[model samples]
Target: MKLNSDYWEDRYQNNEIGWNVGKITTPIKNYIDQLKDKTIRILIPGAGNGYEFEYLIHKGFKNVFVVDFASTPLENIKIRIPNLDKNQLILSDFFELEGKYDLIIEQTFFCAIKPNLRENYVHKMNSLLNPKGKLAGLLFQFPLSENGPPFGGSIQEYKKLFEADFKIKYLEIAYNSIKSRKDNELFFIFLLK
Candidate 1:
């Protein structure tokens, strides 16, 4: 239950990653489609199999990077993106990663970590962004409990956790989420405070 590299690597090794939806979810995909700049330095933390990274690169984004503590998914990304730059695939703890990004893509990463680390995740994400940078993507909406890596959260909880540090540009139930996640995901856009 440490949720460390070994924990995650084992999940990948055992094919137990339930968080991966097999493709970029519609909310995120629609967000990416509206992005006008392809040069932005982007980071996707806990990016299992990196469908977002793959989508970005294929769409001509040049500075996309994905970090996961597990080696298996990073290798998976490398194989899928045969021309990928080595520097773009980072295998390290998300909190230990150092970089300034214009945008940070959050997927199931927040839910995977122990809830106690939520504040630390916020701090690290803020530090890793360039001035006025955005932290965007889905957050699960449900009751919180001790039973999961896909931990659930509610809108009130998320606001109390993030509002002091980020401008809540948008926080609402996602209208375009994939069917399985419909009504259970909040699509958000938070800019640095």
Candidate 2:
């Protein structure tokens, strides 16, 4: 099954995005709250409803951007944030995207892609970040299986996958995950190595 624009659009059209928690999850919100630089360029790839994007704008962040191939959520975002710059909403494949951001906010994008693309995703993220940039957000901590866009992975797997490209700042159970996610989520911060 191709997890392309059509697949994702169908998901949104059918309300099948279980990973979308309506708003930015608590772990990421707490991380964003502590960030001292509001000017940092931030990218949230595969940002379904862009709750993080919405929250950042509310918090006075000006250089935030979100990319998604599906048009449904992007249109939804436009309606929700009428004042948002249209250019900041990129409609393109994340791998083909080009830019340098000081921080890339990962929510569910990592798992949404095919498992075979995991290494490529890491490399693309590496190329997208500016020097010493960071990638921070939540990752599901569960068994890997063939069943989902919300496919899961363990901390050990994540450490091996990201360690060569990033210095693991933290990779552990998320203490503040929403009640639904609870102990099933991992909050992480990784700085480009």
Candidate 3:
């Protein structure tokens, strides 16, 4: 119930990361494919296994970073990308991380946090980005409940939570999500306000 670093480290040690899709999901891949800038600083917080980090680096993106409280996934990424800068593979609490990024990619990170901290998550994300920077990616679209690290959320809730700090560019059911997540994922692009 703590959901602390120990909890996450145990999950990795036990190989219980269901939120890890093993590869970058389609919605995110498509979004990345469209991005023309390869020099923008990007951060992926709570990046278990860091599939997106791998993809970004493979696509020639520089200045990409990933942070996870658990060391296992960060080590995995290091092994997977042996040449990746050590500094870019941040093994620390996401909330404690400091930097300005052109973009922050959200995957299952939001859902993994306790719901009560949702407001703080928004503020932290807002503070992390530079002016006009973006926070984009998929959010699971299901009812909130007590039974998960994969906790669900809806567009209305998201809008109310993020609108104060971001310009909602797009928020809708992701048409290209992997089969398991089809219709259950909302892809969004929120630019800093």
Candidate 4:
């Protein structure tokens, strides 16, 4: 139940990452495609396998970065994108990480952590973003229960959780989620308040 570095590393070694989609999900990819700036600093916390990281780089995004405590996925990224800057692939706890970014891309990291850490995750995300920066991506939408690393949440819950620190620009069921996640995901964009 301790979702620490070793736990994640073991998941990778065992190929137990059920949350990984093996490729960037459509909602996130569409979001990135609409972005006109390629130089903005971006961070992808809990970047398991880094499909999004690779997608951004391949699309000419220069300041993209990824942070994951597990060395396995970070190493996987290095092997997949041989020319990627090593410093941009940080192998460290997301909470302990420092530096301001214009954007932080969230996928499944929020659910992977214990539910008790949800508030801390929001604060940490707010701290890592520069003024007016955004935290954008998909969040799973389902009844919150005791069974998951792929924990589920509702739109109303998310609104209360982020509205204090972020201007919730968008939060609704994702219209273009991958088939597997169709009605189960919510695409959101929250700008720093």
Candidate 5:
């Protein structure tokens, strides 16, 4: 199946986003809470509904940006965070975006793409960050197969994929995952190599 803008947009149009957690997950919130730099340029690609964006803004992180080609989710974020800057709410394909970010967030986005594009995803993420920038967040740890937008992946696969361009700062099962995802997700931090 084509997992393009039309496919993802359709998911939002049909209210079929099971991957959306409705709120920022605990692991990400805890990470953000510990960050001292409020001015860091942060990017959240494929941000469905942007709960993280709202959470970051509420916490006073002023340089947050989110991109998702789906109109429904971007509109939802605008309604939720009424004061969000239009320039930062990017309604475009993640792979086509061009920018340098201090940090990039990964939620369910990586797995949402087709498995063959995993390598390209890594390259795109590497190019999007400035030197020493980081790509951090959660990844599913289940077996991968040909059956989903919520495709599964293992820790080993992720390491092998990202290590070439990023220094693996942390990669392990997340302790604070919401109960629904406990033991099934890995929280990771990959800094530019």
Candidate 6:
């Protein structure tokens, strides 16, 4: 019931990660493609296997970082991305992490946490970012219900949750989601307010 580090670690250890897309998702890929500054510091929290982290490195973004409390997935990412900077592959709980970044990439992480921590998550995200820094990625688009790690949510709910700390730059149905998530995801870009 509690989606803590142990819960996520077990999912990776047992190979039960349905959310591991194996590669960067389309919406995230597209968003990265348009970024003009390779120097911007980027953080990818709850990054399982970290395809996006590798992609950013390959694209010449030197300050990209990935944080996850689970060792298995972080190890997998290190193995897969052989050239990854040791400092960039952080092994720590997302909420407990420190340092400011220009951007944060969200994927399945938002849904993995218990709903009660939503406000804390938002506050932590705001704290991790530099002034005017952005948070961008996909959010599952559906009704919020009790049953899930991949908990679903509506745009209205997302707006209410993030509006207090971020300027919602873009939040809409992601046109580039992978086939399985086509109509079920929202691509969002929010700047620290």
lDDT, model 3, position 117: 90
Candidate 2 residue lDDT tens string, 103-151: 9999999889888899999999999999999999989888998898778
**TM of each candidate vs. truth:** 0.98, 0.98, 0.98, 0.98, 0.98, 0.97
Backbone Cα, N, C clashes tallied per candidate:
0, 0, 0, 0, 0, 0
- Badly placed stretches (over 4 Å) of model 3 are none
For candidate 5, write residues 1-193 as lDDT tens digits: 8888899889899989888778999999998889999999999998999989899999999999999978889999888878767998998988899999999999889989899999999999999999999999999999999899789999999999998999999999999999999999999999999
Model 4: lDDT to the true structure: 0.93
Screening candidate 2 with a backbone cut-off below 3 angstroms (N, C-alpha, C), the clashing residue pairs are: none
- Candidate 6 lDDT over residue span 1-193, tens digit each: 7677788889898999898878988889889999999999999998989988888988989999999978899899878878766899998988899999999999888988878889999999999999989999989998888798788899999999999999999999998889999999999999999
lDDT of each: 0.93, 0.93, 0.93, 0.93, 0.92, 0.91
Candidate 6: residue 158 Cα off by (Å): 0.5
> Cα lDDT for residue 152, model 2?
93
The total number of steric clashes, by the backbone 3 Å criterion, in model 6 comes to: 0
lDDT of 3 at 37: 94
Candidate 5 worst ten-residue window by lDDT: 76-85
Name the weakest run of 10 consecutive residues (lDDT summed) in model 4.
144-153
Pick the winner on lDDT between candidates 1 and 5. Answer: 1
Q: What does the lDDT read for residue 87 in candidate 5?
A: 90
